[model samples]
Target: MTRSIDTLLVANRGEIACRVMRTAKSLGLTTVAVHSAVDANARHAREADIKINLGGAKPAESYLLADKIIAAAKAAGAQAIHPGYGFLSENASFAQAIADAGLIFLGPPASAIIAMGSKSAAKALMETAGVPLVPGYHGDNQDYETFREAAQRIGYPVLLKATAGGGGKGMKVVEKEADLKQALESAQREAQSSFGDPKMLVEKYVLKPRHVEIQIFADEHGNCIYLNERDCSIQRRHQKVVEEAPAPGLTLELRQAMGESAVRAAQAIGYVGAGTVEFLLDARGEFFFMEMNTRLQVEHPVTELITGQDLVAWQIRIARGEKLPLTQDQVPLNGHAIEVRLYAEDPDNDFLPATGTLDLYREASAGEGRRIDSGIEQGDSISPFYDPMISKLIAWGSNREEARQRLLAMLADTQIAGVRTNLAFLSRILAHPAFAKAELDTGFIERHTEQLFVKPSTQSAHFWKLAAAAWALSEPKTTRQDDPNSPWANNCGLRIAQPRRFLLHLACGEEQQKITLREADLAGVCLTNDRLILEQHGQRTSHSAIRQGNTLYLELDGQIHSISAVDSIALAEAAAHPQGGLTAPMNGSIVRVLVSPEQQVAEGDVLVVLEAMKMEHSIRAPHAGTVQAIFCSEGEMVSDGMVLVEITGDAA
Candidate 1:
């Protein structure tokens, strides 16, 4: 049946939603966007030809509501629904529902999704298909005794994985027998909480394994092709942080073997559209099947850059019952491509997700070999209801070095503010020599932990000067009349000379500085020929500056600096009190509160568990103290630095 897909509805958000719509529109298909209440003004929502309101922001109320999504698609007269990964992308019932609703589901079949839905089931199927399987227990017994026996048989140093989970959730490593019980319990709890499936599979943990995956595409015409492999070894908390196509260290023979195995896995289940067959490459050059993602991956950009074929376009075409664009021999695997996920996370703070409005967002030129796939704009909000990824920055080069260098330059040039980002942290990782040499593993981030998580230093002198100039320029004509106590007030002039001295307070990260500028510097701080020339401190520095509201983005050297004017006194006062207070580290929802008023708590006791951007963060007591007050309760949304609990004094 060859049905034309005229109207396509995308049931996702963030970068992926925008990414899918671009291809759908390119194919001349009308794009319909579904947005939650909180995401009504999101970039993805605004980018579509037609928009449907899902009524709520949380996934449960919006993206995860299968019935609502189908209804929206039907209401918009969409011919097909494209589940852009995550949410209900892999839900067998959702696929069946879409099919039953007489709308095409731009993904694998419901049967294929079911075959690979659970880790245990998928491994069994792989073993049956004559593919290499890792040494593990993939049985039906979920009892404690059965698990204990499997762990004992598998020996020490094993991994407990949730059968129906991904994204490092519901996973744990037990190195010793004594820790097996607790590890299993924790893994099962997390698994049940995440996937509603506590069933587990025990596997022998590879000492040092490279996380490699092959991108596979299939058509409804019984044809499949492997588009080569991606090395997603650079990870944090078991989730891929950086990915590159054509995994660096593999020889031609091993690559062929891996690619063949991936095709076999895909063909066995009759996979349609884009899918990834993940494998763990051990130090001995041997590979073992890990799992198969039944949907398009988050790091699919690298694969597309290398193959020169749009995976999203292929998905749409296949959903419309079109044949494969090319055979295996026709697939081009040229050039090296790399992608880094730009997340709104604080690397120094245990990589906790940060949420807030993007006070200033500026991206580098994304053309030709450089690209930034993002759904955020200057004023977009990174809410706590979904993934914290701001974008995926992809760079392509003729060779590995060229691609690495291009990504490094782009990472430095990317400018984002309002919330703490992993920008500086990503720059350090790419600059590391180990990464440059392609020596990577799943533990790459942990191996170079000391160097990669360095604290950000103060902004350059030129940036501060630019910030001062921008603040001065933002002052209104009625600045003196707006507030009599204004620093720039006419009556507050200590020196009324030709070059008036103005003191401006600014805060950059953790450091605050008071920069004094003269009237001559302000007069000469002019934008001429698209360049901001500032003359201050007897030094002249000229750079490109983009001013938006109180924020000033400066391009100094090759790096981008986002600077904003802030009150130094207000920041100092916040830092003044550091005792007996529990403040939310980032904007998040209070998942659990463990303390009460007047309750004596021990030092290091967990007082709250905050859920932000799908990651849980524990708030611990700084010292043993008596709880004086509890200001916030569980399920309540709290902003960054909002005090949740207050203790009077240290416990006796």
Candidate 2:
């Protein structure tokens, strides 16, 4: 029953689509890509042999449109559509539609997806299959009272998760009974927005649990095997940030047990293709089934690296009615591999998703156990229409230490501009003592927050010198083309009878500083190919620096520092607006406007709710004040830093 796949269509975007295309093209299969309007010029679309523009930016308007995707696949002559995780990957209806259209869905059957699609349903199925599960309510009752009673029965500090959701959306940890109502409502709203389902289930919020998941592959012939396990304990907002294969401190017996359980879970649903069974392992080695991801996991790379197998290729083979690549004992546990997700976000500001051009995007050189899987290039725009993930940096080594060090070096070699990123935060996490000692759990980030979160401080003296040197050595841009003789035409401050000196006002983070740059200070400095070399007082230092307009992005001490030159007008505006103005942190649609014109509000009160990157963010009051004006309405799309509400602070 094996059918040849002459052409393949990837019905998703970003790294996963690009990743699948790489393998498909290598195997001599013509690849087709379907993109939204915003992704017309994206890397995934550009790499494919043929591309179809689905029209629109939002997921619901584009990638999630299953019929449009199937039609595009047919029009492109693709025999199979690979829903590469996210979008319609785990969607049972989308899978059924592809099958109904007589096209192969490079994933599990619709029936399998349905069995494990909902967390509540999956928990019940796992319970029936003799898989250990945390005590909770998984009933059909969607009333608030039902959830309330369930939470009470489950005791305080319960976890509420969307029945039809993954990736932390529609999930919340209610610490007490008093906060259950609001938490439930917020979770339901997020669930409805992300998965179109407001149904939720409650479970005990396990303390200090390690998130370990097994990678299982099944074929149409009923052959099933577990590739290995990945520890995705390092997370933020319930989304995995760092993942690694051969979970630290996992014994051979424990691994075998988990792998067997995962295989059973997959076989129980008559699953085929790649899937993941997530488990929460406690301190005493007790494990409980969390849920099953019916599609490939985002952290699949770690398993591939450890097992030396292409899970995507296995999926394609399985869809073509082939048997499993390896048996239970044939799965290899080679070395260790680690992956960290690089995102366009502000870690200092609650990891809020950032959007803008990738002004100066650069990646660490791949090879020698270092791999960078990304779908973005320099000068690309990170739109609000999709995920803010820039790339996933993966490193493999002979052991965990080697892998961790390689990843740290990779982070140091990477540089990004235009938007804030978590590169520095990631570097600190890898360098942290606790992480080095394998003190990992779901609360790893919070448990070691003080060490992982670096506070914003003033730039160092050497940093100022480097910034001045880079600026002085770089060619200045023309300000006025019409009048070459005008004083404004000369960007460099050139006086008629004095040494050249420039007055620079720099803004870095929240600290602003003024520096006087003299030509003599840059006498022994040079900038060639964006590499800055400075020899000051017989001390030589080299750094990578990129100058874009009035902004200078310099990599100093393994951290990227974005410093902008501010003019007098910018300074005046900053001084005038000393009171914290409520602005959209990122490009997103306004979900709720909680305040009105001239409304009095207390400090820390939520002013507006904004939905971006599939998560909700609150624009809270900086201080007690009176809302002078409301400039934004609910459901309005706003750009980053766009002022939504203006408030006059009380006398301060």
Candidate 3:
């Protein structure tokens, strides 16, 4: 079965695709890229040796179409196909199809994928294989009453998850019986939309547990070995936000126990190639299997950094009938590595995905300890059609503290503009004393919300002054050569025999402030290399600043603040429509509009649900009001800030 692969096709898009291709090319294999029409000019497509147009932007239309992907592989003369960890990555039928087409599938056998494909089925199999499992119901009975009864039996707090998917989609936590029905409905809807499967399972929600997962690899020779573990406890909404390798504070005995258990789970299903078995480790060192990801994980780079191995290269070799690269005893845990996902999301806005052009994408310099894995470049757009992850910043150091401090510095040096991101939120987490001390768990974000969710509005008066100066200095000015004393030449309110003064209105997020700038205050302000330098009060300071039209994106203390210079007329108009309606928080399609015009609703009632980046976000009623009108219909695409509903507030 040692078949040679001279060409490899990546049947995916974005960073994972690009990352896989980089390895394939390094191994002298011709790399092929399959892309949708929207990704025709994407970084992955442009970097591949051969590119195929898959013809649609949506996952269903392009990436998930197994037949189209197979055809693309055949047409591109590819000998093997690599499904890069997303759409179709864990699809058993897709894997079987690739094998039937006489091309190598760079993943586990289709049988292994099917065995672990369903959460309910996987738990049953794991139970038979002697693997530890959390107490929950993983049965075929998905009825509401069944789940309600299960919840009552398991406890008040339980987790409802889509049986067929991961990545936090179709997952909900029901704290009590009152919240179970609606939570189940929403979870089912999201499950059906995201995974094409509405099956669900209820599990006892473990409290204060750390999410530790073991990375394992196997080959055709029935050889399998675990590659240590990753601590992925820092999360929001059940999705991992930060990951580090060689989980802190794990004893050798526990590591061996978990690693051996993970290998057993994989071998039970005859797993091959790269895989990860996730577990929830309680404080007492007991771990239970959560699930298994049959494809390469998003946090695989952290493992690679610590192990000094190319997992993609190993996957290729494994498919060619190679043996495991390293035995469990030989797998070296070198230095420590930590990674943070840089998402195009507003951390202050419930981490809702944001979409826009990456107007000024500049990553920190990658050297010995700093690494940046990204598929986006400057001017690239983060569309609503896919995941809004801009990049991942990873740092490796001699120890855990060294890695943490290095990652903190990396977060500081990185910059992203045009779209809201979690950059500042990441920096705060790294700098937090608890995190530095390795106090990690799934509820870390919730526990430290007061400190992590610091508002940009806490900026000082001097910060606002600098912002105003940058805006004023960036103003477009024209001068007449014939008249050196033209008033227009000095646009900063230059006047005859008077102190130059101007009223500036700046808005950051929902907070707006008016700062009066006088000539004396701005006399020492100058712009250089996209930085604003201030020489005021006999002190000098500089800030990274840029003016894109009337919006000033200033970097103060490693956080990007988007300040819009609003005119009085615009401000008056905004105040005029204080209660006009609810606007879309981000660009997406209206999945459901629950309220009809003229219908009365209470405050906090769910009204409109929008689907963006393959996730659904609900827009609720802001106050008790009557729905005056709804401007959007189901399936209609909407932009951020576009008014979707108009309501007339009820008078007390």
Top model number, lDDT: 3
Off by over 4 Å in 3: 455-460, 473-519, 522-526, 534-541, 564-579
Across 1-652, the per-residue lDDT of candidate 2 in tens digits comes to: 9887989999989999999999999899999999999899999999999999999888889988888999999999999999987778888999999999999999989999999988888999988988899989988898889989998888889999998868888889999988899788888888877777788999999989999999888888878998889999999989899999989999999999999999988888899888899999999998999999988888888888888888888888888988887888898999999999998888888898988898888899877898888998998889887778889999999999999999999998898988888888999999998998898999999988888888877788888878877776665656688987788687664678888877777777777777898878778888989889877789997899888877888889778788887678977897887754677888999999999998999988889999988888889988898999988999899988888998888645
Q: Write the per-residue lDDT of candidate 3 for residues 1-652, one digit (tens) a residue.
A: 7899999999988889989999999999999999888889989999999999999877778888899999999998999999988778888999999999999999988999989878888899999988888989999888899999999999979999998788888999999999999899889988877777889999999999999999999988988999999999999888889999999999999999999999999988989999999999999999999999999999999999999999999999998888888877899899999999999999998999998888777789777888888888888888887888878899999999999989998887787888989998999999999999999999999999999996645668877888888887777765455665777665653578988776888888777779888877778889887888988789998877877877778998778888897778977897887755689988888999999999999998999999998888999987899999999999898998899998888646
**Candidate 1 local accuracy as lDDT?**
0.84
| Runs off by more than 4 Å, candidate 2 | 476-503, 509-511, 535-540, 569-580
Q: Count the backbone clashes (under 3 Å) in each candidate.
A: 0, 0, 0
Per-residue C-alpha lDDT of model 1 across residues 1-652, encoded as one tens digit per residue: 6888899999999899999999988989999999999999999999999999998766767888899999999999999999987778878999999999999999999999989877898999999988888889988888877878888998878888888768877688788888788667667766665556688999998876899999889998889989899999998877888999989978989888999999888888878888889999988888899999899999999988988988998898888888999998898889999999989888898888888889878787766799889998998998987888999999999999999999998886677777778887888888999999999988788888888876656677866777677656555434467587766675225565565666877665566678898777676577654357877678887766666666566656544456667855766796896554789988877878888899998888888887766556789888887898998998898988898999766544
TM-score, per-candidate, Cα-based = 0.88, 0.94, 0.93
For each of the candidates, the C-alpha root-mean-square deviation to the true structure, in angstroms, is 4.2, 3.0, 2.8
Q: Which pairs clash in the backbone of model 2?
A: none
Model 3 scores worst on lDDT over the 10 consecutive residues at: 486-495
Model 2 — TM-score against the truth? 0.94
Q: Give the TM-score of candidate 3.
A: 0.93
Which ten-residue region of model 2 has the weakest summed lDDT?
A: 470-479
